[model samples]
Target: MGADELSATLWRGRRQLDFLLFLLETQLLHLRAGNWHRLNFTASELEKVLENLRFESLARGVEATALAKEWRAPDQFTLPALVEIAPPGVWAELLDEHRRALVSLVKDIDGAVAANISILEKGPDEARAGLDDIEILATQVNIERALAAVSEASLPFLRDFLGLS
Candidate 1:
């Protein structure tokens, strides 16, 4: 692309990140608000907001999406920071829960997928199943390590989310 187009793409990507941060801040507000009556928009409140939203808000999202496609693909243009929530230290237990849940899912679903697909593709091999089981066990054992990593990654965001700033 030309220099101007590339610069515009970069600008749009930054705007996309800002929009994500806006949504995150709104969510934090909703969560801190307690009940439904007290709080306005948790992410779920999008349906209502969309239904009643002014053209300006609607237009911003559409512009963001179209510009995002120019900037990057429609599937996943935003940075990884938006997907994560809270801080590692502030909510280590929750972080650990997510890690363990992932490991558990991998053990149950991926383990089965590998085992069954390997048998069909590569013939009956005890090693595949045995190693799959080993992987599951190893992931379980490494949960603590994984959680520590998660905490380290999430500290800055956590501090910001909790208004520790």
Candidate 2:
């Protein structure tokens, strides 16, 4: 990807991360309210948000991989590593140090999601068999998987961008 394309891709990925964070925060609120019905609906909505995140992450990954390949190969037109792609000060300006901040935020969200999953899984034996509860559990599992996917997709990008890995 060209510089502008790469910049756009990073921007889009960050926006998707923001949306995922919002959804998870909302889920936490519903959990705190002990509103199972609303929580169920929130889980359903989270499914949709997760789908969008996956799509965005996938596209971002493709672009980043393309750029990485270019960085590795000897082409007539060289592609720099992500950190070298922009001017010295441009990346720092554009991302505003938030990429590192996002690392922490994602970790916090993962912990919160896991805690909720534990609570859901530990409900009374009688409640476990209900299909609705099972569906909710399944959805929560999917959310966890999606979170992993987002991390897997974005980590390489962040690592290359921040030289963190």
Candidate 3:
């Protein structure tokens, strides 16, 4: 739970966020292209990443708490608080960088999700306009199942990130 360990966790979390953003972009492309199969796969991948992020978040909380206690900061200190109290050199700068990058990544993810939702709101007829009867049925089933699973698992994480709960 030292600064180095906390830094490593932050680094890993950033990479995970980057991968999540990539998946969101890919999911949006598949939605626009009407590639239901790939979209389903991406949805599953997103679930896995979200699960990993949940665990990573717990680990980060523990590490951050320990570091905060070591530094004599108040309870439930935020990354910004940590940055403010960090030794005035590489650690302070690095933590600030991580915080900024995470914020930007979260905003990008939010934008991508909004775009995907907009395309989805256009309805199945527009999305599946070119598909044959069988393809439409299969796509509908697969997309429904995949999106339901993702939405169920993703809502809490999104809510937490967006400070909704």
Q: Whose lDDT is greatest here? A: 3
Instruction: Give the local distance difference test score of model 2.
Output: 0.54
The TM-score-based order of candidates, best leading, equals 3, 2, 1
Clashing pairs in 1: none
Q: 2 or 3, which is superior by TM-score?
A: 3
Q: Considering every candidate listed, which one attains the maximal TM-score?
A: 3
Compared with the true structure, model 1 gives a TM-score of: 0.26
Q: Summarize candidate 3's per-residue lDDT along 59-159 as a digit string, tens digits.
A: 88888888888888888477888888997679889887888887778777778777766665554676667778898787777676556534543435433
> What is the full ranking by lDDT, best candidate first?
3, 2, 1
Query: Over the stretch 2-120, how does candidate 2's per-residue lDDT look in tens digits?
Result: 44565577677667666766766676665556544455466666667667766765676676567556555333221233444444666535544445555665565566666566544
lDDT of 3: 0.74
Q: Report lDDT per candidate.
A: 0.34, 0.54, 0.74
Error of 1 at 22 (Å): 1.1
What is candidate 1's CA lDDT for residue 99?
Answer: 36
For candidate 3, which ten residues in a row score worst on lDDT?
Answer: 153-162
Which residue runs of candidate 1 sit more than 4 Å off their true CA positions?
A: 36-41, 44-165
Q: Candidate 1 vs candidate 3: which has greater lDDT? A: 3
Model 2 is weakest, by summed lDDT over 10 consecutive residues, at 73-82
